[model samples]
Target: MNRPTLLVSALWLALAATAHAETAADASADANAEANELERIQVTATRSERAIGDVPNTVDVIDRERMETLLVRDLKDLFRYEPGISVGSSFGRFGLGDIRVRGLGGNRVRIQTDGIPVSDAFSIGSFSNANRNFVDLDTLKRVEVVRGPTSSLYGSDALGGVVSFITKDPSDYLEEGKDAYFGFKIGYDSSWDGLFGGATAAFGGERWSGLVAVSHRQGQETENQGEVGGTGSARTQPNPQDLDGRSVLAKLVLETSENQRFKLTVEGNEDDTDTDMLTSRGRQALTGAINDSVIARDHQSRARVSFGHEMDAIDAGFADRLDWQVYRQDSQTTQYTREIRSGLAPPTLRDMREREFDFDQRAYGLQANFGKDFSTGSAQHALSYGLDVSRTETRQKRDGLRTFLVTGATTPVMSPDVFPVRDFPISKTTTAALYVQDEISFADGAFRLIPAVRVDRYELKPQADNIFTEDNPGVALSDISETSVSPKLGAVWHFNEDWSLFGGYSRGFRSPPYNDVNIGFTNAAFGYTAIANPDLKPETSDGLEAGLRFSSAAAYASLSAYYNRYDDFIESMRFIGFNDDGLMVYQSQNIAEAKIYGLEWKAGLELGALSDKWNGWSLRGAAAWSRGEGRGPEEVEVSPGVVEERQVTRNLDTVDPLTATLGIAYDRENWGAELAGRFVGRKDRVSDSSLYQQAGYGVLDLYAHWAFAPGATVNMGVFNLADRKYSEAGDVPLVNGTSTLLDRYTSPGRNFAVSLSVNW
Candidate 1:
């Protein structure tokens, strides 16, 4: 485990309660659950507690009540339901996850924790959390996913959209007359022989309230066994990660008066990973793939502090919020020697360390909103305005070494042997940004308009001397500075209380990484080449979104469509011949243009009667389609020495064709049950140098619960019931190399877990 792992020992206790079976739970507890189903659904799309229906944009919300019984642990488990969204894991661990929104990648899909941006800044996988193996999935309230281009509120990365991880706020769900809430849970997984346990406590009063949670888990190996139940799966990705993780979240709320109060909170994330992979020497025998075993260790830590205040006025209010944070991350990789039957080469050892590498971000921003409702020229207007600013600095190190492996099992299922190699020069970076927004509602809220803009100035400083020297130069010396402007416009017309129509236009972008701009190093940064293009430009998008929503107290439904125009897309181009260090490296270059378009539809309704017995049962469903393509592009590099401005390859506008979900849920005072199924179609997505056209797939999940004792009960279910075979993944295509040797599993197979919980 890395050094940061110990810090997690002190944290909030949020357990992913699990049970293998799908059946009715305890009785009176079910009665207690009935009240929860009827409560209001509050979302932070506009930084306020407003009914989801009131928001004009398309927002996917998974409530806390569902979060509890469903046992959704990581990003993948939580987001697979939305067609407009796709998720991936890093090293097959829960500590890390990648998200793609509206066919846009992670960096463009701004991720926030409690409305604050919280991802790795190294620009490697475009996420700071990359080195940390598993992301802690504990007591979370709900995840709010804004589908489509969201350049208005969030800045750069909001090009694709935004996903805010909102953890449970202690005072909202506590029992009446009780000072606090306490819960404990224990569970297990079949894939990795993994075991996990956690606990949580929350306290509240008329004026003050707070919550804290903690959780931990240990695992040996997890099976990959591709697409189970089809032919034969018992597959494996890498067992290199001997993993342990912990997280803590704390918050305080103070009520100053009836009209206002204050809120302060803190969050921490840490992971300790010791990875040692297990693979087949000659797996397929047909394709003659090569497999290799290995070991590695890494660590990560992130901390954040936030404060918010609100004051009431005559039918209006003034709200102010401030958020700040500091984060540090490190990664190291080592190769060991081969033992017996691995007569491919004599066992060798190499050391690779990424030191002097620190991801630091010092950001303190303020957002002040002055909102009011007044009659003006026979119309009522609710106007709000605010400002936002933040700065981030990131650095990378090549202090890592490589070595061969020994004492580990040979590559699995008859795979090829191993060969040793080395590369030089690591990459590093830093950035800063500032912005503002204004929203307006006219004619008694019949029509609402919002316009916002953000200006960002980035400084890309690359320390070439650290990895490369003036004598053995690849990158030599290069530093870059650039500025960007993003704007948003939207309007919603409430035809009536039960219906509304909305249209939105937004622009978003991302600056090229320092490594991608000035690294003369070989590929191998994250096992892929670290290409640099000094002239690389920022990626930009301009999109138009239109939608309609028909909602009532008992039913809700929505339909929306979007079209995106992209400019100067940043792509990691294909690699060329061996460099001075005899290593292959791909180039990070910018493209002219790309286009994306999509549609989404969703509906919900109450069912099973509204009276006694089956009173709270409801049915819900949603569907979406998206496509991405390179437009008016140029340049083609043929083998040898031929370069021509070719139109491009794989510019098909048919990626992520369709995604849909159907669910049945029972919400009661104490007893509840839910069953949801999903189907996603094939994707034909592409970029500058490659395209990934994959077959679509589907899965079904079952969850149900009942209350037996006063404070104890059981919840159970199955995920991917049909044992579906599918990949919600995309990557730059590979060459003639045996993937079995260097590749990692991208998706999880049919798996199940069970747990019991006690709360009083």
Candidate 2:
């Protein structure tokens, strides 16, 4: 069917299925029940416990049931059917990618697990961890996403949005009256030729509880269905990743009193990947470098330990609750490569070359929050205040060794390396922040207003590790400091029990990262040298959002719009022949101003509410459209020894295409199934660059779940049901502003997966 026809048919099916399922009175009762259940779902969107529906913001929650039903294998799987968020995996690699929200990504968004942040942001060459893949999906019970600037409460790194993963606790597994429980799960994915298995055990007593979980996975490389250039071509995208991963989680909880508790959690995860990097199609197409053999072994791991305490009753005046947590985390990624090349006429390397690189970030943090409830005349108020402090130390190292031999020479000699690979130095950053927020309800709960503010201080100290440059000159890395203040205001008007209108305005900020500020590099091959930029300013954003929401026994829907403005955007500028050094100079500077706006709509219907005969049937859909434009730095040589830097206004390359997802589902006690379609609109407004323009496409998927007996279930999914070869919008490889190989980064072809799980 056509796009419009398909959408109309979907609506008709939803109404018809529900119309014959139940009577009006039955539907009303069902609506009430659903509303009640929704009210019980609590969230931390405002830094305090509140019902999901009561929060004056746009948020998405993926609970454990949904996670298990979908048989999620990675973080990207969680957002496959949701709008406003897109997950993109790096080309030629298995796991490294990014999660973009509302045209912003990378360091603009913040990721957290149980209120503890992960690693710092740093990307070099083809290797990156921008997706926050360090967390173990097996141990997670839920994932929450809040879109838009939240720096008023989260301090920083929340310019685009926030993603929080809630892990499984002992209380989640134990029965109402039972004190202990254990379970295991096994899954397989044909696309990656993967196998995964996990087990969990938990127990709780009168005053103490504990839980432990372990999971492991092994997978071969992922396959692509398209040729190198998307047409009849002999070359195709290379697939050479072989991966193994393991994760462990342990927690302990003690109830000091009826109104107090203490908890400790320790979690660790590791991933090892073996791949042929230099021989990949993208690499070969980039520089015409043919490879005899190129092998890369990369490892990534993360470990975190956190201690927390909570009390409902505190002695502080008017304070009804107190919460505190202290945590220490270590995240690291290391890569070792061995390659040999000889096919080229002038070979870069005819023998073996071995290289090692390491990037590590260690963090320690402390957070405390207190909540109070009171009344002021005709308004009831809930106030929350908190203090946060954190210190992070980042270190990087690299060493390259090569062995070469002439065609007639028998012995290969180790040669001295001339060019340096990694130029970033060890850096330490300390951040301290204080924040406060208050939720006030007036007009007898008909109107609610939330006001919040946060102030932060950041100190950056480089280790003076870049004392000697590639030119054998001594240079000093300066220390930098910055301060930022963010504020937010939101209000919700409840016209009646079934409908509400809400809006919010907030400010966000992002400090310059160590890699960007203290970058030191000299590429002789490219005739360029990059020095540190200690005068960079922090980026800031101001956003306004408004939305309307309505819910009934049989259906629920929301419509929202937002506009955001950013200033002092950091961008890299390259200037040639502007100085006496006689080499091109590159530096990061605050050089841009931008504005972005978008509209979003989501709706869901329950067929069971229409008639008893159509019980367990439902329909749901979501759509988002966003566009942004900003001024970026560009350098042009006006005359000899004279170059001018200009700020050009253009569409941002990070903005994703308009996207939507529609699904029909049937869920019951014994069996469940769903059919979904994802659609993308063409992206042409971006700059006339090969990397930004993308075409529109659509794909279908099917999923099913069956419960054979108590606690025994089987889930299966068929993705890309029609085997259509289409690429996701904005998913492309960046080959350093060169190379025209854009079609090598498409999504995987048709794939199937099945999972068997049991709980007791």
Candidate 3:
């Protein structure tokens, strides 16, 4: 990073503060009274408490109460009822259940928790799991989904949209003046023959308050439902896989004064998965049996501490306010795969890919913002300046073995000696960023504007070559430095009680995966073996969006559109060897251009003519459409001459076309019933020339809950009711036949689950 260049950018931004002295805000609804303005408490789309109808963008809010009744176990489960969102073909079984917002799908979007960026270090996560899984829905207060890129406000990877889950505060755990409370729950599922339990407690007194929660769940997979003459079923093996997991979460706060406070949060999460999977596709023989292995054994722990003095004076100047936070994390996971096939050439097949990893990351950040009431100035404005520095270091050691089909040639063509072995030196990356944001309001309250800028410097280093064993030498590597300056500009107008408009544009970019930063490969089975090329560049994008809002306490609607233009995109090219282990490997390359465009819509309604007892019933929905194309060197014409003729696909075709959901719920007295359905669009998502596409499908899920008492409740739900037939998105064409298919996973049939809870 060039220090002089960065300083110049910061100076220019600082001067703009004096020129554009307009009051800025996230949204007006956040500052309003939640109890009085039930219409404005939206967590998604925008930050402030603006009604969905009054904002120009698309946002879908899943209130905390709804989650209690739904009994969701994973993040994908949360999208089943949200508008303009759909579960991708991966079926949410793994994190691969890509989420499509406003036509943009997969990792193009961003995921956050309580305002902090979530991890996406894996091979470009769209709907795939990460170092740690998403937080449980039960622990969340509300979910906010903004349907387009706002990378200017944030930095890096904010392409399609951003989804943030906000957790509840200490106040939510207390009962009036009570100092402590407790709750317990247990659940059972038929599909997985699962068992679940949870407990929570809260305490508050004098200047301190805290809440603690713990939970566990165990599950067994359902038996196969398909009847390929029970030939392909391979029922002779283990019919059910098992999983066990536990988690602990806590939040503590100390209040020193009315305007000063301190808060701390800690969480430990871990899960063990024993899964039985099959390699049955369209052309593969049913003779190949299903595989069994300990799919995942993951554990993670994290802690965050922050202190703030709301309104304080610093030395001789009125410093407005100050806040500082520090964070740390430790996590590990070991994944293994084994074949339990029946009639293959090699009756017994076993392959194990093991990774023992340890990483530590820390952040030190500070923020100071001045309050603006206009009483002392002609224009009311608040300005915030902050500095953030982070450092993360990780060590990785992976061991793997893949089994191949042995023809009548008994020589064992690809033996272990020359087969595949992967080991990479420990890699580390560090970053330092500085930023400033300001908001100004004019004409007392009619107009609001926000302008912000951030500058970041990153350093990447790879350990020097060393001997791992007596005769083996580690590979040599290089270090890299990256710098970027991002900016945003936005404005909003309150035309009247029923009309308003908003427009904004943000720039975002993503550094390539750390693993790909330095390494290349020659012999790799499931992972890149070793072909280190430290010259790859980061992908950048400039995105813009416009929206409209209209609202009433009882009803509201929103419509929005956005476009993201990308540059120097990192892509994968087919420059490789044969797949001795069934899976294909590609040499990653860089592309010059690509663009994604989308539209989003969402609305809500509260009934007025119905009985007062049913006044809580509401109707809400959202839908989105997106399309993208490649325009650089990667887009050159090609011919495969087979089942596939010619088509267009940008990098991974995981992008879904259109996803939508419409549902109505009745929150009557103590009983609630919700009928929700989710849809997934089809796409030829393969990065290969064949461009195999999966047809789109939808599934209906029904849930009901009853509050038996102040501290007790029951929830029952049916998943995939009506036994829909579908697969999560992975698919490819047959060897010689055009219409024939291969290797696609089908979602499970209808299943029921019930849970009971008690609290005090």
Candidate 4:
């Protein structure tokens, strides 16, 4: 049978069995009752404690239970079922990728941990990847995603949205009435072809608390069954990878007095990956009739330290709570590559090359906030104000060497001169911001309003190295400073107990990072030179959103739509002008205006409410659709003077295809199982310069959890149950300047994973 037919058949069989299977009715009823006692979920995405529904914005929360149930091993695994989001593997699974939201991605999104930014956004030679995957999932308590502009809370890098990961504390580990706890878990994954394990210990006391966690993982190459480049005749080989990592977390909390507390947190991670480059994308040295080998070793490390204090004992009448924090984060990535090529005729090594690239970044910041709550006649008000200051520094270096093996002798291929492949000098950026937000409720909490504003000042300075400056004597270093204000206004009306309406308008901005402002390179082989522009302006966004939510004991649903406009879009622009090297030059410039709009919806239903027979079953689903276009400068020579015109509507590359997820879950007192289907629609809309398009595909996953014994449990997941081979939207990009897809980078197909965990 065909793939689709088999999928339908399997689904039918599973549904039939679930519907007719004999189960303990009384047991199922009790399970339904237990599930109905849902706890209120609070989120810190808004920089304040608020229930999920109270926030006048689109927010999604994934708790520890869901993470385990879904067998989440990494960022990609966690976001598989999330709508309007796509994680791109531009480089490879190890590094060089980004996460997209709505129709924007890359540096537009801000990723944080415990309200502090994590990794630095830096890419050169397309080697930079989103540094989000280094964190161990076993240490995370929950993750929250706030969709859309959030500059009113976070200063910059909030143009698309914010993804915040909160780690576990002593309280999360200690059971009720318990002062100390110890837990450990070990698991394996078929896709990764590896084993993983972690352990945690926590102690809680009246005045002091402490927790420590350690995790380690090692795995082989990820599996992929799809054809090379989505074609039958594969010209390039596929590369296999070796991966391993370790993570450590430590936190301490001290209560100095009643209503006053202080916390110190330290987290660190180290990951190393080895890849066979001959079969990797864009690294194949021999197309046919020859044997070649290329190996790449990538090492990444991250560490962060934070100290914070929270106090509510202030006697000042205008303030009820105050909090302040200081943090420092450091991230580094280094890659070493070696390649050897041999001719089929003699099967002897003929050429060899070695290359290395290093990128490092550090950030230090301080933040403080104050909150006040009061009530007037018939009205309630809550106000929060905060200030943030941070300084960031980055450095990049690259070196390469090539040799030819002839007659059992090695000969150098280049002149004896110092050359840097990626020669970006040290760059620094300092940012300062102050923001305030106020929430007001009227008509006995029936109607609410939120108004917020933030002002930010940014300074960018470039420190050129002697090696770079000496090579190009005419090159000049410059500094830039910019300031902007972001504002947000929102309103919500609770018409009844189970239904509410909300709408909001917000503004966001993204200041150009050091790389964008001072990036410099000259490639004589490519006949091009690219230089950064100090005059480049920051990217700004204006978004308007409206939605309605319905909530009850048996069902919950939400529908939202958003429209966003972006100005001063940053993009690479080429000018056919002669430089000192007499080569065409490319410059980073702000040359476009764009618009994006999308719709999102989520719903869940408890079948038990309909009848006693269906009490243990529930249905949950989510869907998202987005579209965007951009306008760029187009100049035309007229009869007299030149005329500038905007080009026709051009599709944006960041927009993901229409996607949806549907699932059915059955729960018992000690065990539960879920079956889910994720569908991705065809994406024929290609950007102006894009040469590839992604076909539609669907995947069905089965997950089950069982506590067979006291303090012990097992979890199982069957991903891509149909074994349908496919590729992620942005994973398989078309060959640059051509319509043919590349010969690598396809999503894995048909994998099974099982994990065992014991807690005490």
Clash count of each predicted structure:
80, 8, 39, 3
The prediction achieving the highest lDDT against the true structure is 2
State every prediction's TM-score relative to the real structure. Answer: 0.76, 0.90, 0.77, 0.88
Candidate 4: tens digits of C-alpha lDDT, residues 1-760? 1433433343344333323332322224444333321223645545777766677888888888788888888878888898887787643435435777886877789888888887665554433342555567778999888889889889789999988889988878777688888878888999879799988899988889999999999998776663443212252224567898999999999988889999999999888998865333233343443335667898888899999999976888868999999999998888787766555346454666666778887999999999988888888988899999999887777666666566555533333224463355588889999999988999988898999999999998888887566544455566889998999998888898756888899999999766666656665666766676889899999999998776555655677789999999887544636787777877778888999987777766666765687867887777787888988866555557866564656887778878889999998778999999999988767674455666788999999999999878899999999888787775765455353334355666788888888877
Q: In TM-score terms, which candidate is top?
A: 2
Which residue pairs overlap in candidate 4's backbone?
A: 96-129, 97-129, 608-615
Per-candidate RMSD vs. true structure? 10.3, 4.3, 9.8, 6.0
lDDT values, one for every candidate: 0.57, 0.77, 0.56, 0.76
Weakest 10 consecutive residues, lDDT, candidate 4?
A: 18-27
TM-score of 4: 0.88
The order of the candidates by TM-score, greatest first, is 2, 4, 3, 1
Question: Which portions of model 3 show Cα errors greater than 4 Å?
Answer: 1-59, 83-110, 123-134, 222-239, 277-319, 338-378, 400-424, 465-476, 520-534, 572-588, 609-616, 632-652, 679-698, 728-744
